[model samples]
Target: MKTIIGNDGARPVNSTKILSPVPPASTLTIDHVSIKIVCQYGKLQMAKISRSSDTAHVTYLTPEGLKEARAELEFLKNEKRAQVADRIQKARELGDVTENAEYDAALDEQTLIENRIIYLEDVLRSAKVISHPSGSDFVVIGSTVKVEMDGEVDEFTIVGKMEANPGKKRISNESPVGQALLGAKFGDVVEVSTPIVRYKVKVLQIK
Candidate 1:
């Protein structure tokens, strides 16, 4: 999921490869074998873009997104944990461990709950809390932007992938349209292209 942008052009590097030479098996007892890896690349070059002072300011997530995330974490900590513990205890009481469907289901539930708790914890830690700033007319990460397309006006808020709900007009900053609108000012026309279509829209307001 690494992204590299440069003046030359962007190209995705897949898994890099390394070759290892085999040693004689007779030289040592082959109880087990392991190898360490190292990588070196020669003189990498890149052109950097100058940052514009007026480039769009982004606020990562809205208060609502933060609240929802908190609620989810609470559910995972309280309700989900309790439910899984109860399932495990009930399964244990059923006896015959090897043939127990309930025990297997309980274990599966435990695995899922633990994984989700880890994910939620990470999300809460990394999430940027967003608030609507006073008197700011420019679009920022969490500011809801109004855009005009052929006389039709639509509003959407820019958000990170975790908080974006496109159906609700909350777009991920990584998305094409979102990227195009990143630094746009009112009355500025920005063109966005996707694999399926192209759109020409004007920035109207940042609320």
Candidate 2:
């Protein structure tokens, strides 16, 4: 028996097996069987048998983003890890660890650093670097787009989710505006819809 859990409720099936060729971002377990499901940008795709421990997913990154992640991972694994270890050792020398606030704080910081190191390692392992767009004929992952909406002109670069910073005019390709602008050409108008509002923007340039 296989069961699917969703917003509506749980639905069960008999004499059926679920399988997904590619692993997704999330998993669901039913009847001791693990199924992979992809949930991104408010969309969901379910099906694929795998162990719950298998949590690898493709991380999209630009060339610079990939370099930054690599640098961070290197620093964490080499310098930061040793620094935390030294702190823990120094704290341990300061009497009973059970009652030592410095020891506890160092341990906490060590945990955080280790967790980040693991995350960055995983990201690096599963990264897919976005290639530079050719000619900017149409919007792509690395395109810097100029747009006009509500009589105001704005510019932003479309990057992977990991490098997205709205404050810096860098938006994720998965975002509503980026999705709408993708495949649009210069002087083309596109509709951007979000839960909060729906509006139109005209593509003024693509770089």
Candidate 3:
């Protein structure tokens, strides 16, 4: 398993003292960006870090990614919305809305679902669908890149921040590795620095 020992940005000049994992709600800076982190019992939240230029309304997506998002939105709007509404209606029939536990729970679920629906709607509304820029060899979102780091050969598909899953080798464009490789070509050496560990990443190929 990979590990990261955060640096407090207070290390002596060139000092390499490694910091162990911290408690919940800890804030730190990695790559000059302010990152708010919360870790509970060693389980880290998979945060979707945004690009410096990102706007709340705009989201970049590939065709397949867009399709997936649209499908999820439809499900949430049609199925999940109906499910929660039914639960609320049934709960309301039981007794007072103020004292009913089932009613409260149903309302809470409804709020969460509606919030997500709004977010997805905004994303779809402002989405900028893009393909691999023609004749461009530089790394960009939707590009499959092969990299060598710490003697491990791996390939990663760089996608937008919304679709990045490190476990699946689909890295977010705003992530350390993805950020480093953006606009880089094959045979380029990139540095990936995180609060945990830093490594030299060499680009081998792009597709």
Residues 86-199, candidate 2: write the lDDT tens digits: 998999899966457887787677767766776677677788999877687899988999999999999999998889999999999899998999899999999999999999
Question: TM-scores of the models, in the given order?
Answer: 0.61, 0.69, 0.69
Candidate 3 residue-wise lDDT, 23-95, digit = tens:
7666665654445554533434323232222344557888888998899999999899999899989998998
Q: Is 2 or 3 the stronger prediction by lDDT?
A: 2
Candidates' C-alpha lDDT: 0.68, 0.80, 0.76
**How close is each model in CA RMSD to the real structure?**
18.1, 15.1, 16.6
Model 1 lDDT tens row, 1-207: 344577978756533322233332212212232222222121111111222333344436577887887898899898988998898789979996545778777776766676667656666666688776555656667677889986899999888777888998989888887888887777889999899999898998877
For candidate 2, the per-residue lDDT at 166 reads: 99
Which parts of model 3 have CA positions greater than 4 angstroms off?
Answer: 1-57, 132-135
Model 3 Cα displacement at 109 (Å)? 1.1
Give the lDDT ranking, best first.
2, 3, 1
Q: Model 2 off-target regions past 4 Å?
A: 1-56
Instruction: Score candidate 1 by lDDT.
Output: 0.68
| Model 2: lowest-lDDT 10 consecutive positions | 39-48
